[model samples]
Target: MDTRRLYSFIKIVDAGSITRAADILHIAQPALSQQLSALEAQFGQQLLIRSKRGVAPTEAGRALYRHAQLILRQVDLAHAAVEVSGRAPAGSVSVGLAPYSMGAALALPLLRSVRERYPDILLHINENFGGVISEAIMTGRMDMAFIYGAGPLRGVQFEPVRSEDLYLIGAPTDGGEAGEVALEELAEVPLLLPSRIHTIRQVVDSAFQQAALRPNVVGEVESALTLVNAVDADLGATVLPWSAARAILDVRALTVRRIAHPVIRVQLSLVTSDSQPLSEPALAVHDLFLELVTAFDKE
Candidate 1:
């Protein structure tokens, strides 16, 4: 059986509709339907039940889908084995990262290091919000991502990098809010924060929910830079890691205070899809990320 058809079959099952899968695969809908039909014919088993809502896998299709995912990953691993043995790893490695995560600070340095280490390797970085990055990884749009602390996502694996303390950032205050500030203080201080959809916002809200405190939200800003700027202008305070607010920290006008009365730390993790195999170039970059973390520990 041709692996391309098997791959196409898995895509249809994941998408739950031939038209949706075709749009994602960038193939005509009829051609995609034909591929599915041919696969079922070749196997002499009905694979899908298409209805008005969408398509769903039959019992046979469910069994094949499980095996197809494994088979395709193994085939890709075999190809990766050949590529690694041939020469220095070369090809594009696409990584998804959230703008509010540590990835924002590391992107430039990591790109430079990869170029110096592997001249032929092309590194592609896509920055997005945490939820979008997770979806991209699940759908195979990205090889991996550095994302916020999240519960298990289907077909995704997360390896913890480090935990970082969250800080309360604002303009220099005559109130002498220096080293650390209490969580209760945030109840009174107006907050400039991301909306509920973002993972960091979820984390922040959960922490407050548990403590029975509510921050007075002044604005729900999407961009990290805008949140920092609002804090710098003394409009309100914001909570974030140093990595997310590094640009504004350079200015002398801002004050940084670690959250206390109960500390909050966002867990950073290196995430990858379990259904995919890493290519030689992708593996090399994954190793580089670990090395950078080791170096960071020393500093």
Candidate 2:
């Protein structure tokens, strides 16, 4: 396979227009079209669906795009390894932080640490849901991520960071207390939580199931602001890690209580692609993240 054609195809997919890709690549439209044609012919499949809006990748094209990204990233890593050998690690490192987790609190610190320690390296930080972040890492679109799961994901390896205890967060007037509450007591408390697809929801659900109790979930909320606002409005209570809760809410205004009596906990892990080796800069950031997390845990 011609890597040049792969590069062109990737650009076309990203730009969503052949003309735009041609302009970016500084090549004639016809030449770029020919490269696309050659790729389709070699693969014996139509890779794109064209329309008035532009082109979108077909199923095969999406798969190829994922592989192409990995291939291109590996090539870049190889070039960097040889060119910057023994020099300060330098290049763009993309890091994903799962939203509403301990990662949210670490973002600013991570940025400052990376900027101070590796001035030559460019850092791209992304805050997103765990599933989206994990998929990005698996596809080589992100160098690493701190996500909420340590379970088996096909293309990624997870290093367990810590098990964070889940706490109940509610409005101040709604029995504002600092003591631990049992899982049984939460069965009747109206709750607002993220959807079932989220790791926290899954953990909460499983814990309730084992206790043979159904939680009174009043609403499905995915936004941090909405969740905090809903809780503050006395619409319902929510569950979260202390770090996550503190990141989004003012502890003084809300009631925070640790859940106990069958305490619920969620695993946090550092996730990286199993098949792709990290470049020096990425590895450096990875270690720095671990160091920061360790120090934060101690505090």
Candidate 3:
């Protein structure tokens, strides 16, 4: 297989136009088109659908794009490994941190630690939802991620970091005091939570189901800032892990009550690709992440 053709194909797919890809690759448009044709002939499939607007990948092209990304990443890692052996690891490592969890608190600290310890290493940090981060890791677009679930996911491995207890945060006017609150008591309280796709929402929903009670969820909020703001405005109460609640809310200004009568806890895990081995720089960042998590847990 020609790696050059694969690279060109990826560029074409990303740019969405043969002319744009040609400009980016510094190759003639005719030559780039020939490469695309050769790739199509070799695969015996029409990889892309060309239209007046641009080129879009076919189903086969999407599959090839995924494989090509992994292959190119592996090739880069192999070169970096050999070139940086017995030297300070120097390369870029992309990491994802799932929002609305412990990741929110650790982002800045992790960035500072990496910058101080591995000056030669360039770190790319992405804060997103768990599903998005997980898919990026599975596709080899991310070296690793800290996510909020330990459930089995194909094409990735999860290492348990810690579990966090859920709490109810509300405005001071709506709450009586700061103490443990039962699930039954919250059945009537208007709630603001993330969508059903989120792991936190899934856990909250399951607890409600097991208790044989339906929560009065008034809104589905995906943004941490918006959720906190809504709760602060007395629009509705929200359920979140203690770390996330504290990181985004001022305890003195809000009422944070731990949920009792069957405490709900969510697992935090470090996720990595099952098939792709981390490069030296990525491995270094991974170790640093674990170390920081451990220290934070102790504190």
Reference-based lDDT, each prediction: 0.80, 0.90, 0.90
**CA shift at 38, candidate 3, in angstroms?**
2.0
> How far does residue 174 in candidate 2 sit from its true spot (Å)?
8.4
lDDT of 2 by residue, 1-299 (tens): 78999999999999999999999999999999999999999999999999999999999999999999999989888998888898998999999987779998899999999999999889999988888988898888899999898869899999999989999888333353457888888888899988988899999999999999999999999888888788878898899999888888787787788998888999999999999989999999999999999999888
**All-Cα superposition RMSD per candidate:** 4.2, 2.7, 2.1
Point to the candidate with the largest TM-score: 3
**Model 3 CA deviation exceeding 4 Å by range:** 171-178
Going through the candidates in the order shown, the clash numbers are 0, 0, 0
Off by over 4 Å in 1: 6-34, 42-77, 171-177, 247-251, 275-277
Cα lDDT tens digits, model 3, 1-299, are 98999999999999999999999999999999999999999999999999999999999999999999999988888988898899987899999988788888888888999999999899999988888998898889999999988969999999999999999888343354448888888888899999998888999999999999999999999898898788888999999888878778886788788888889999999999999988899999999999989998888
lDDT of 3 at 296: 85
Q: In candidate 3, which residue pairs get closer than 3 Å at backbone N, Cα or C atoms, i.e. clash?
A: none
Candidate 2 whole-model C-alpha lDDT, 0 to 1: 0.90
lDDT of 1: 0.80
